[model samples]
Target chain A: MKKLMITLLAALVAVVTVSAEVPAGVKGKKLRMALVKEWGTGTHMIMHINGAKSEAAKYGIDLSVIDANHNLAKMAEGIENAVINKMDAILISHGKADALTGAVKKALQAGIPVIVFDNDFAVDEKTANGKLVSMDQYDLMMGLLSQMALVQALDGKGNVIYNRVANVPPTDKRHRIWEGAILPTYTGIKVVNTIDLGTSNPMPKAQTALETLLTTSNNIDAVYAVWDEYAKGFYNAIVASGKKIPLFSVDISDQDLAMMQTHPEVWKASAAVNPSLVGRVQIRLALKALAGERIPRYYSMTPILVKSADLPKERVSMKDLAKLYPAWGSSDAFVEPWMSTLKK
Target chain B: MRQEERRLTTKKLDIFGFFYKYGTILVTIGALLYFSLTLDNFLNFNNVTNIFRSVSIVALIGLAITISLTIDGFDLSVGATAGFAAVIAAKFMVIWGYGVVPAVIAPLLVGVVIGLFNAFLIIKIGIQDMLATLSMMFLLTGISVTFQDGSAIYNFMPIPGGGIAEHTMSKAFLAIGQGKWLGIPIPVYVMLVVALLVHIFLNYTKYGRYLYMIGGNQEAAKLSGIKINRYKLIAYVMSGFLSALAGVVLAARLGSGEVDAGAPYLMDGVAAAFVGFSVLGTGKPNAFGTLLGALLMGILLNGLVMMSFPYYSQDIVKGIVLLLALGLTYYKMKHKG
Candidate 1:
């Protein structure tokens, strides 16, 4: 009687496994994905995840999603899980490279393709298995654009106050953009002061610093912020102090876009990059590799300026965000999507 | 005979007595002088205003710490409690369309309830103060997140009951955070009143004497017919109440609530308590000394940042200053006769 019951249970399990559809475009195969949580990116992370899920669905791929939640150990665990599950590809939107190195190498040894989005640690422009999904760091683009915006705002000359965050990577990149690119272009745009608002409670700190900056120099024209939150903070201080200042930053949020559309007077402009697009492309590229197609080692997503007048006429709802970008939208990513960020 | 009497009086005065008599005052003056000479922007009116304005929140947190530390109990949850209250106030005022007074009171009342619960855990259940407060900190953080739906609640729209063609809430709110009366920041005035009241309550009142005796020697005070647990609970409750008040003031100042808000004050409050011990050789918590300590930390950080040091490094310097203050306390205590 025990043997007969065990036989019945085994047959049921096999039937259930075979009932699920194999993802399209691939050779009747399943795919696993890992997402790294970058806090402050917010809804964009969800978009990226949705893109991956949608792409997997389109290509006959079963994508297993794992979220790192901005922790390195958790990310590594995701990578390990992907390897153990025999996933076809791994997608990582990392802030630091060192945090995910071991897991990437382990996945590589297991014959899995790793496509890193946004950030990485390798200097050789290659992945753990010598395949590269991204060649250039967005920080470089962010820095170049930030400097150009500052120079233009300054009219090629004035005191530029740089409000920087300590112990963060992108901020360090922005600083480089200020020192390496922006400062050299407009020698007249002298950097009069650089305030470190610290890692935490930057808004109030930036406000207090701006109040002091107003007293220090009447020649200040532009301010550069690494993130939208930090930019908004400095902008708030500038507004509260009643100073006419041009503020620029890297990532743009729904609130930022909405604010730009209605209240353009407050924020001048922001260089916006879509992580959702990156997620979609990362999944597509990973699928192509699984299908034995030659894909580019490095895929670059150019940064675009999303100004007040150019807000998207056709806005994507939070629920359908995954339909737009399948990978980012799946799992718990579905919610009040127009505003809240999905990544962190 | 007169010469001998004068000589005897002069001989009795010792080094510890002189140092203790003028420690906090001397340190404050010395700090001001040192910053004035070294820092380029130290003397500017704008810088001075900025420094005082920034110090207000820390001053409030320091007061919160003082209440707990006086009874020889510690609160690791004050910072988390402040953050929780900020988010709660933001949610009520902005999302629910509540009046500002109700919004502000809601967080404070929540704080009082939390303080009461903390007292219950310690006084009734006999849990240790540090462990109880730490557990409460984690609980409040989860509660704050749940209340806010794990997102920032921003209210940038102007208040509906506008009269003066400006954000009446902004202007009225700004008064508590940024307003000045006779050139002193409003929060500073609030801190001053709180400090004076707490000083009177802790020193002059008979209940205050019992609190001190309980802290000095709990067994002896209990034997002397003191209700030890009741006063201890009161100390913690006051800590919670002040922490919540600080949270509301911070929300008013920032005009929003962040999940990670009120983090820096956790360490800053602890530093203030240790610093008060070294002030005037009090070797214990005192209102004026904690005020000086809070200001001292504020000035040190403000001056260091102005001097172009990174914020991370300022943390290390703060730790060193705290250690030095502890050393001073130990030295004073060891030699006290």
Candidate 2:
């Protein structure tokens, strides 16, 4: 009986010791964080916000989301406001680095950890006296995957309609791949037309332009859309024209998924990183940095290629996307054991 | 000696007037001719229709600006009103699952309400037209963002707080933007019909004359028993309705409601209206001139795109052309004064 009692005691002790616990600096603390975005529009941005919000809730964090509405000045001001309010950390998404660098420096000077997604800042730990985590979605890989799919699907020989939006960092990177890698590799693929419509409501403009192109030119084989917004337009134009041109693009949303599934033959494939996963990963990194964890200065999220033929015929939202591709909706990166206990 | 001086002045005025009237038309023709000569298929029938289709929305918005100018008032809210109408239309279809008719008519009603609000602010409160409309612009933009929670509205889109939108954009609505009848784009027909109606209303109607007289001199119009306030009300209402129409067409063309979709048209619309002031030596806003101004811009932009002009450089070209057009009109005015 004494031996059994001692065994029970040992087991009890083991269970108690192995239970999850919050990290030292974050334990029982009412933490505050701010997510300042350049703009919060479209499914991608909304998903990012939703992911961050859900993750922040798990940590009992007071997360405030500030949308600058595509105004750089306002985005800069958002970081300043967070610094003034003395938030625990800051997360910035998509702004001109030049406009945000000074504000980021201010936050760093205040000893606040800053994690930026997609927007590059000049500050480092040595220069800014604080932790700065720069995260990218690996747009280059996204470009390569989508462009290669286009070239491969066409068998490297066809007339193509290429859409380009210049000056934007992601689009610029995508275009660089097209200009340098794809063009050199697929010499048989002839670019019959290049379309660039200024970014506001581009779908309709792209559709109109493509419709005109279809009427004006013949023998077009396929199209490469750098952004899914352009892809949506091209898809619609092709449908309206009753043409059988295949489209390949970057980025994914519930709407884009629906279109792709409905007409897999046309919207052949798209390469994208789950936007919600991006938001969750960002929060994870921010929490890790706050807990005095060592984090790399730069991190990139891997992108996945979603082919239309792979999707089920039934409609699926971003939530359902994970069943088909596990890595897409969930990320294990930057997750610490303490995070499990931090959940409210 | 007095007769000789009068004759010299008349000749000079005639020469200036001739250029003012024909300058925009001549320049448009020169561009068309040049593009036709230099670019492949630039003068194709389909290409010409495409250019008109592209500018159709801008032309409608320009007509809205022109109407506002008739009463010496500028409706800066036109673009916002158009955007607001688009959001409301999309909500009716994508969110509320309503039919096409309500989606179209509801926004027109909203436009009327906006116009009534502008009329009250400008006529009753005696606020400056520019300030009143500018405030409306900001208000509508904020309301639009708030309405859809800052995301665009499309068919089967996932709404905020959960669940997917049920109804997609209807075929009839898409046809308004994407469909063509008799080998011409539908928007081109809409633009031409609206322009013709506005031309008749502005040039041949007593109401248009009263509005112009009020714009020329409000006090003089009031003294002449023209009911200046009533005329100003008419001008603003027309502006609001037309801007809403432009927004509707834009929504149809895109088949989705994007926030600030109509915002880009504001500058182009205003430019077309101002440029119309010197068209045909009218020295004032007119519908035909506004249509012509939009066409000129459309032709130049389309030609530039075909020529492989960089997109960033295209804006510079637009600015330069705008400056040249305005410089001639204002310089002539300055000289006459």
- The local distance difference test score of each candidate is 0.68, 0.85
**Docking quality class, candidate 1:** acceptable
Residue B327, candidate 1: C-alpha displacement in angstroms? 1.5
lDDT (tens digit, per residue) of candidate 1 on B1-337: 9999887766665655666656656766787899889866687886776676777787778888888887788888899899888887777766675767877788889888889989898889989999999999888877886676555555542222531112123356546776678876787788888889888988898867777888899899999999998898888888898899888878777767766577667888788877888887788888777888888877777776666566777788778777867877887777666
Model 2 superposed RMSD (Cα): 5.8
For candidate 2, report its TM-score. 0.93
How does candidate 1 fare on TM-score? 0.81
List model 1 lDDT by residue over A1-344, tens digit each.
57435534543443355433222324333445554443422345555676777666655566766655456787777777888877767777754667767777777767566777755555343334444465233666766775686677667887666766655665676677777766776788876677776656566666656665665456777777766667756766676666667776767654455445435666777765565666666766675444333556665565655554444344323333344334323332211121121111
For candidate 2, state the interface root-mean-square deviation in angstroms to 1 decimal.
Answer: 2.3
lDDT of 2 by residue, A220-308 (tens): 89988988888988988888678899999999987788788778899999999988878888888887766665677888898989999
Docking class of 2: acceptable
Candidate 2 whole-model C-alpha lDDT, 0 to 1 = 0.85
Model 1: share of native contacts present? 0.24
Q: Whose TM-score is greatest here?
A: 2
- The residue ranges of model 2 lying beyond 4 angstroms of the native Cα positions read A1-21, A128-130, B1-17, B159-163
